[model samples]
Target: MSNDLFINLFVQITNMKQSFLAIVVMTSLVIVSCKKSATTNTNPQYKALTEAVYASGNIFPKNEYKLTANADGFLLKQIAFEGDIVSKNQMLFQLESATQDARLEAANNIFRQSEANFSDNSPILDELESQLRNARTKLANDSINYQRYKELYERNATTRIDYERAELAYQTSKNDVSARRKAWLRTKNQLYVDLQNSKSNFRVNAREDDNYRIKSFMDGKLYEVYKKQGELVRRGEAIALIGDANEVYAQLAIDESDFVKVKVGQEVLIKIDVYKDKVFKARVSKLYPKLNKADQTFRIDAEFTDEQPNAYYGMTIEANIIISQNPRVLTIPKNYLVGSDSVWIEENGDKKKIKIIKGVENLDMVEVKTGLTEKSVLVLGN
Candidate 1:
């Protein structure tokens, strides 16, 4: 076609292209501005929640006790071994007393022999007394006869031989009397010595009988066996450990910081791993004074209100110690708190920061002492 017509058509097409570009740019800018304005009107939302300190620990019995021997010693025959149920007077152990047994038997035998001898044979004292009486009677009779002979000799009615005989008879009678006296003295001395010896032997026998065997002091369920037969044990050394299975308690170890807050007689809520969702009521019975060196924790003892069957020691427990019981306090979710207990608040459609004073809290909810009212909306990131 013509040159003028071709040039006009090219110019017209270029102008039209420029106008369309301008319109597209203006439309995009309006949409962008609209989105930016919409975003500025809305504040960042946070999810607000109030929660108490929710920590976890395992369950322990309060009445459980660990038994230990005060002195070191070898084990002997255990009358009651581990897990043996025993009565109060039941035997638990027999310590090494072979020596005591031997000694006692010897002592008892000696005593029995002495008793038999004392009963069967007449006492030396009695025999000596009888002999003395007989000697006295004989001496009296001899004196009478000797006196008569001496008198006859003195009167010169008898020969010299008769006088000599009379003198000899008198002297013989005197000597016999002296010999009887000496015999009595010897017998009396022997009786005194024998009596003293008998008493001493009896004491040795009594000691031997008592020391022959070791015995139990109290009736309990035997949970530990510390000794075996024929093991040498020192005096006062423990042979085994016993526990009362009839009653058991739970024990909980708490941090040193929480130690001050926990007090005796406080009620605690206990949950066991084995007993899920089951709440057991417990009363604080004891609070230990000394801290565990390794764990830096102190223990608290609590007894179950209801009789818990099959309660064992060292089972894991989670406890919630109710320090305060402020029910129905203004509370919120704990997640909203920022730094050092700070929360984000919305004011006039702008993000505003506020400090909140929190009180007793658990895992989910916290008691809000002071902060925004209940109607205040908390924006959680959507």
Candidate 2:
């Protein structure tokens, strides 16, 4: 085409291009203005703030303990069941005691025999008494005969040799009586000792037999029964779980980092898995000094301050222990903070970073102690 026509075409194309560039620039400006307007800004406001430490634990009955058997045997009878209330020293189980029973019978038989031997009517004692009586009679006769021989010797009514022979016979009879009496006394003393030993043996066997009947250690409810009737039970084996039925407490594991902040009587907010929608209030009741090395945590116990939920043993729970709180303080959303100790504030349409003194802080908010006021506008950091 002609030079002028070509030039006209080029100029039209150039003007069209310039018009498109102008529209794009205007669109960019509008987008930029929108984004600036969309930037979030907040002001410090007076609000209640709480600082807490997170913990996890379980619910446990108070004074819980395992009931274990003291003697090995087959469980013959289960006298108590789960949920049964038992008194201290009440029999809860009866173990099979065939061997013990046999031993007890033997002990009783020996004890009865020993009793017969010790009684006044005992055959052994009666024989010893008869022997003693015979000895005494012989001694009395020998004394009379010796006195008669002495009178005969003094009156010269009998020969000296005859008197001497009579004296010798009297002395010999006296010696025989003394030996018989001594033997009787020794036999009687031996019988008495044997009876005492048998009585002691019977008592020991009786006490051992009683161990087959397991009894409760406290007045509480039975939470679990580990063994059923006819189950074999070994000594020191746990047979049941027992604890206070009406009272329960939270056993918490606090992290070592947060352990120092926990103390007795601190308020706790607990959320149990069973009661998902409800929050229970409690106070720290105990703090264990020993650290659990396996998990690097310390044990803490808390008691409910309000109505407790229907909780069972070992129910998992999450808790927040309130360390400190401020009823009303100047606070800002935690996202607005730039770093550990500074925040971005909007000043005269410009963003400025300023240092702040932070107090109590939670996951969502931070209490501003000395940096921003209620009127100060805070800018969320990038």
Candidate 3:
């Protein structure tokens, strides 16, 4: 009986030891879980917040082009300075056309040389008159001789050979007059050819000279003058820069990370670095499809909808591209999200549990997609 009581006591002690071990294990598990939950709720403010992407870039107009000169010409004059407003067809710069003028003159001289070949028939008229007078004198002499010979032959006072001789003399005189007239006309015709050539040269020279006057083709502000006075410029060289003042745009580069999020026609906020406190509203007019190799970024152009005084190109403007918006989404402070895919939520007092989600987690808030509801109060930071 005594041995049986001892065995029963030993069994009771074993049961108590197991019970104590179980309690300790349970307590340790509770403590570990509580600590984890508390750690996740560090950022209490962002627990109930919505999530979205954010990006920033520069602002610029969609239509931007660097104006280069078509030819190297001396920058003779500039109508306006870099910031001066100008109209369409307004002259940006007056490249000294002296060189072109000289070229045109040279071309004209060449043409004139060709035209100087022109000679008029009238200029040979005096020679024709002299030839005509000589021909008339020969004809008269021949007629007299022919008449005398004819009279003598008719009277049988001359031989047949004499009559034939008189006839030949008259015919030779007539032929000489005809030859002289023909030669005179030939000389006049040659002069006409020379005159035609001279006129052609003039036309060619006129055409070459007119190309020197360069005109402005677009309305804008004179942004720059590349060539200066007396500066010899070559053909097809850049001389001036112009940009539209009325229709201004913001030009900026966006990072590669934010490239996919930006789209044309998205509204963006612009803050001009030069001008403080003033915020400008702009719309993305174009997004460059190709990435910039140098910066590993894409170019985005924005048109300023908000009119600002004294706007100009190359003005650095901070741009905020709106990715997405949620009117009233649930949120929690970002610091509260401490777990690998979850956050801690306070149930009553210090008691906390894990909340899980699969959505955007911004710098300030964690978007809850699942395992959590707007009904629960999340602990952000202490």
Candidate 4:
């Protein structure tokens, strides 16, 4: 072959090789660009994030109490019924206690009779006082005669037998006075003891009879009436239940796993079934230390900040106890997350998987603590 023809063939082969390399490089670039467009792209946003633990609870009155019957009897009258606003010590029911009333009346009559017996002019005291006055008069006269006899004996002007007789009369009068005073004091003391006994009996009988009237011990609305009129109630049986409606509290059941996260004074977002459209605010007021083994939950009592939802007892509620919060942080939409610790990103026109360090998360957003930057573009909703 000629030398020029050989050289032209070599040049043609070299150009074809260069063209093939160019086509391969363009195809690779096209494939990478298509992959980047196929995925949804978004930027990390700076926003607030909150972490919380879920809990369920019930609504109850602040101070609830049960009223029980103090005595056994037939319920003749029920003055207060369900939904009645009652005051402290208000009569709620009356039991049939005719026997108690009869006993009280007899006690009062006995008390009155004993009181009359111990009055200022009692018959026994009057008779004793009259004898005491007569004895005093006789003793005074004998004392004067004894003085006269003693003077006469000293001067030897009277017989010794007359003077001795005068002394004996004076001694007898003194003995009479002492006997009368003793008798009067004994009778008065006995009557005073009987009077006190009667008074005590009356007070005891009155107190026993007063137990028949069922009274409210607290001021609040009566929410339940367990017993009705004409119902036979025994001692200490529950007659009604009542509580104050102005203040309210929630009894929450928290999962045992979240026991350490929850604490007193933490903010709680409450939602009640009755008030579906509203969210109430409260704070944890108490924490029950023991776990309810049957349900694997612990009890938390929360109190409302301001006005509470107007609700009855046992109303169901859902609550979220906010454990932590971050006001300013870079985050990604929680739905864009592939798993707990990783997300896909569009880096240099290709889909690249990168791991992230997460801090706080909620249903809306997740906080990105590290491994990703503000300039990084994320492939969302893969």
**Highest lDDT model number:** 4
Q: For model 2, how many clashes?
A: 0
Which pairs clash in model 4? Answer: none
Query: Model 4 TM-score?
Result: 0.77
The TM-score values for the models, in the order shown, are: 0.62, 0.82, 0.60, 0.77
Which lDDT value does model 1 have at 101?
Answer: 63
TM-score, structure 3 vs. true = 0.60
Model 3 lDDT at residue 95: 59
Better of 1 and 3 by lDDT: 3
RMSD of each: 21.9, 17.9, 19.2, 18.9
lDDT per residue for candidate 4 within 1-382, as digits (tens), equals 2334223222322333212111001101223333434457767766644456667779988789999988899999999888788999899999999999999999999999888889997887999999999999999999999999999999999999999999999999999999999999998999999999999999999888879998888788888998878889999999998998677799988778888887799977677778644667889999999999988888999999856987487888777676775667877766667889999988889988889998776434567899888888988645
In candidate 1, what are the lDDT values of residues 1-382, reduced to their tens digit?
2333223222222333222111001101222233432431222212222121112345433233333333333445566666766665464555455565677677767666655444436465567667778777877877787777778878877777866776677677778778878987776565556656876876866654443344444555666655667676665565666656666666777667677776777765565667655556667788889988887677777777764635354567655454544524655544555655667767677766777786654333345677767666554322
Residue 204's lDDT in candidate 2:
94
Better-scoring candidate (TM-score), 2 or 4: 2
Query: Which 10 consecutive positions of candidate 3 have the poorest summed lDDT?
Result: 20-29
lDDT of 3 by residue, 85-181 (tens): 6666555566566666776677667555544443332435676868788897989999899999999999999999999998899999999998888
Estimate every model's Cα lDDT from 0 to 1: 0.55, 0.77, 0.57, 0.78
Model 1: per-residue Cα lDDT at residue 10 = 28
